[model samples]
Target: MSSGTSVPSPGCALTRGRLAGVISDDAGRPPLDAARLAAADPDLLPGLHVEVLDAAPSTNALVAERAHEGAAEGLVLVAEHQTAGRGRLDRTWETPPRSALTFSVLLRPTAPTHSWPWLPLLTGYAVAKALRAAGAEAEVKWPNDVLLGQRKVSGILLERVETASGPAAVVGIGINVGMTADELPVPEAVSLAVAGVEVDRTDLLVDVLASLWEAYTTWQEGGDLAGMRLAESYAAACATLGSEVRVDLPSGEVLTGTATGIDPSGRLLVAHDGGRTAVSAGDVVHVRPV
Candidate 1:
C-alpha cells in the first residue's frame, strides 16, 4: 500500500519559518521527559527507547527503516514536524511544527498474522480512551480515525515491515494539539486547544502510549479480539457504527448503507437494500438520511 504524493519542498521558507518558531517555543512547551514517562508507569513500555526528532519526512518511514535494521520493539520515534506525513489512501497529512503529536512505534507482536488487522482498531480505541481521560469527548470513526465531536483530531496508520528478526508492525499516530484556526489544515480538523482542552503534550503522549501498550499486550495474550475484549471496547467508543454512511471503495465504487457492526476481523459490516457487505478497506463518510 505504498504510494507517493508531491509535497512542497522541505526547505521552503514557510517550513523553515515554522520550524524556527517551534524551536523557540520549546522552552515553554512540555518536554517529553523519558525518565518521567517511564516512571509514570513502570509496567508500560518497559525498556523502551525514545527518540525525539526536530523534523522528519515521516516518522513512520524513519521507524520502518530502523525496524528493518533490527531496531527492537518498544522503540518510539517522535517528530516535531513531518514534511511528508501520510494518512489513509496515501493522502498527505501535514500540520504546523509543534502543533501536533506525531510519532511511530515499532511493535513485534506475537499474534498471528491473520489477527493483525486488529492493530489499528486497538490503537484507535486506545487513542480515544486517552483523549477522553484527558477530558475531551473523543470517539473513533471506523478504521481508526479519532474524532472529537465529529471533527477529526487524530489519525492512525499501521504498516507491516520485514525486520531482520522477523516481521513487525510500525504504528504511526498523529494528533492535533495546539493548532490555531489559521493553522488548521482543513475545516474538519480541530486541535485539543481549539476544543477547549488545556493539556500538556508530554502527559497526553504518555497516556496514549500506555493505553496502546496495554491494548497490545492484551491482544498478544489472546491473538483474537473477542478473547481480549478489544472488540467490545472499540465498539463502545466508535461513532461510525449504527450510522447511515457512504463507503468509497478502492475500485471506485461507492456504497451507501447503514453501518451495522464490525466483524471479529475488524472489517465494517454494512447493510444495504441488496444484502450485507463486509468492507475490509475503504473510505467511510457518515451521511445524513434525507
Candidate 2:
C-alpha cells in the first residue's frame, strides 16, 4: 500500500438535543466520516469498504456476521456508540456516544492458524505506536491493552471466524477519546482529552488503521513473530515487561511473579520463585514488587 495523508474537513456542529435527543454535556461530539477516513489513507486499505453507524450493540459482532457472509478482507465497521460492546473475556465495554473510537476490521490471512495469536498483540503495538505519534505517549500492556501511565486508554479483542474460503479474524479496537472525567466508564480508565492530549478523532483513526495495516502485512509475509520483529517491538512498548504482576489463569489458579519477557509464540513469560512460567492467556494485574 502507498503512504499518503488526507485531512478531514471540520464536522458540522450538532445543535441541542440533536444526538439521539438524549441531551447531555457531551452531545456535540462529531461523528466519524467514512469518506474522510478513506481519503486520509487511500493507499492503506486498498479496495476498502467502510460502514459508520450511529450506534450498535457491538461492532465486533456485526463484523463477525459480515465475515461469515464472505465480507472482504478490508471491511471496516465503526460505531459511534456501542451499547453492549465487549472486551477480552466477555467483559462489558461502554463509552458515551461519539466519546470513543469503537471499530472493527475484518481480515482473512493466509498465514498458518498457529500464528494467529499474535494478531491481537500486533494490533496493540500498532495502537500504541499510533497514539504515541499523536502525542499521547501510550504503551501496550502485555497482550492487548493500551495504557497511559497505569490507566487504560484502549483495548483490543480479536475474534476468529470460519469463512467459506478460510479462517478470518476480526480485530476490535476501542479508544477513549473526548470523554470527560464523569463520562469515563471506570476510574482506572482515561481518554485522550483527560490525558491532556488534544487530538482529532479522525486523524487518530487514520493513523491507527494505517499502522495496523503496515504491521499486518509484515506479519502475513513472515508468519512468525521473529520474522516480523513483532516480538522485539512488542517487548519494547509493553509495560508488563520487568514489572511485578499477578496473573489469574483460566483454571482458577493465580501466579505472582516478575514479568520477564514474551516468548516466540507471544506467551507472557513470568519468573517466579519456582521457575519461569509461560502464561498463554490470563488476567494480568501489575502489582507492587514483593
Candidate 3:
C-alpha cells in the first residue's frame, strides 16, 4: 500500500506499464511485473489487493503500519528488495533487488483466538503445496520453513498486531527465486533457479497466493487444526515429523528427541529421553544420523 495514492478495490480496473517498478540495478535478479500482479487474473487473489514497491525495509513492518492505520483485510504489500527482512527470533535476511518473492498480507481472522497459532503452520503448508505443484520437491520443516532437498528455499513469518478495526495478522512470505548458488546468504539456503526449478516469478507469486488463501480460509473456518484434517495434511507435508530433532528452546535448554507429531494447538510434540515436551517456540534442527 502507498501513501497519497487511492487504493483500488478488487474488481476495479486499472492499467499500468508492464515492468513499471523494475529498476536497472536489479539486473542480476529477475523482474517482477507489478502490472501482472495487480491485474491478478480473475480467479487469483480473489479479494486481495497487491501493491508492489521497488524496495522496502520490510514488508511486514510496512503492512503492520497499515494495519495500525485501519487498513482493510486482503491488502497485500510486496517488495522487490528487503533491506531488513526478519525471521523467527528476530533473525534477519536480505534479498537483493528482484531476486526473491517477498510480500505480506493483512488478515483479520474469524477463527477462535485459541486456534490462531496454527496460522504460520498453515501458511507453510500452502507454500509447500504450491512449490510442489510448481515442479519443486518441497516440504515444510516444523514451524514454517519450506525446504528443498534438505535446504531452506522459503520461509513464513506471521506477526499479529492490534488495530482499531480489530486484531490483524500480517503474514510475510519470502521465497528464493532467482538467486544463484553464489548469491545464497547461507549454506543451508537454496533458490528455485539454483535448485533447477525454472519458473516465472509472477506466475509463482500468483500460485502461491492462491494456495495460501485457500488453506487459510479453510483452516480459519474449521476453528482448529484437526477440524478439517488440517493437522493430518500438515504432518504429511512436514519433513520434520519422524525425524531426529534438536530443539534449542528460548530458555537456553536444548531438547533432543524424535519429532512424533503436531498437536491441534500447533505445538511440536517431541518424544525425548527423560519425558515428552510440547514445544511452543524453538529453533528446530533435523539431526542427521552419524
Candidate 4:
C-alpha cells in the first residue's frame, strides 16, 4: 500500500448524466456502449456520479485522481479498456477491450484510515454476494479474491487517496464475464462464461455496488463488526476451509497449515504446527489432495 499523497491528479469530474455521452473505440462492442447502458437504467445508480471513458491509463488511477479533485463519494469510473490495470501486490490485471468489467468506486470511509486494510476484503465480499445473486456459484478467498468452484473469477485492489476533506479509497474491481480461455492472460484464470454461465455485466455491477453500499453502511455503525460478517460470508462460500494448504507470506516465507477460518479482524486463522497462527496477509495455495 503506497502512502497516499495529497496531490490531486489532472482530470475534471463529470456530473451524473454526463457520463452517458462517452463512446467506446470499438464499433463491434455493443454493450460497451456507455450511452445505451446508462440510458437503460438511469435510476439504478443511486447518489453516485458516473464517468465513462473509451480507454484509460487505469480506472483506479483515474478514480483516485478524481477523488483528489473533490469527486463526491460513490463516484464511479468505468472504462472499456485499461492500459495499466492492476491488482493487489501490483499484479497485472488484464482488461482487454470490451471483454471485462473494469471499474473503480470512490469511497470516503467513516471508519478510521488505519482500518482501510480491510477494504479489499469488504469489496471481495460484495463481489461474492453480487455473483451469487446473478446465479453464479461464488465465494470470497481470504483477503481479496472471488472464486467460483475453486477457480478465480474476479480480483479486487483498493487504493487510498488523501483528499483535502479526508482520506478515501478507490476500490478497483475487474470481473471476467465474457472472456474466453484464449483471451485470459493467466492460464489458471476462469470467467463466468468459462464456468458455463453467462452474466449481464450491467446487472452484475448494480448488484456489486448495492452489496458494497450495504457493507459500508454496516461498517459505519461501528462495532467489532464488518470484518466478522465478511469473514463469515467468505468462510461459508470458500471451499478451502478445513484443507491443508500453503501460505506465501510477503517476507518470502511459506508456511503449511490446515485452514480453520477467519478471525474477527479479517485475518486467516490457520492451525499450523505452531498452533493457530492468525495470518494477517498471505497468498494461499491449496495443496494437492492426498
Error of 2 at 201 (Å): 0.8
lDDT of candidate 4 at residue 227, scale 0 to 100: 57
Candidate 4: residue pairs that collide: none
Give per-model TM-scores: 0.86, 0.87, 0.90, 0.83
Report the number of the highest-lDDT candidate.
3
lDDT against true structure, model 2: 0.79
lDDT of 3 at 67: 92
Which tens-of-lDDT digit does each residue in 194-283 have in candidate 3?
A: 999999988898899899998887886655434549889999999988988888765566788888988878888889888888886434
Off by over 4 Å in 1: 1-22, 26-31, 223-228, 282-290
Kindly list the per-residue Cα lDDT of model 4 for residues 104-184, writing each as its tens digit.
999998876556666777788878888888888887776778888777889888887899998888999999888878887
Rank by lDDT, descending? 3, 2, 1, 4
Candidate 1 residue-wise lDDT, 18-97, digit = tens:
22124545425554444454345455555465566666788899889888888888877777777799987687889776
User: What residue pairs clash in candidate 1, if any at all?
Assistant: none
Error of 1 at 269 (Å): 0.4
Off by more than 4 A, model 4: 1-28, 32-44, 225-227, 282-290
Candidate 2 C-alpha lDDT tens digits along 142-162:
788999998999999899998
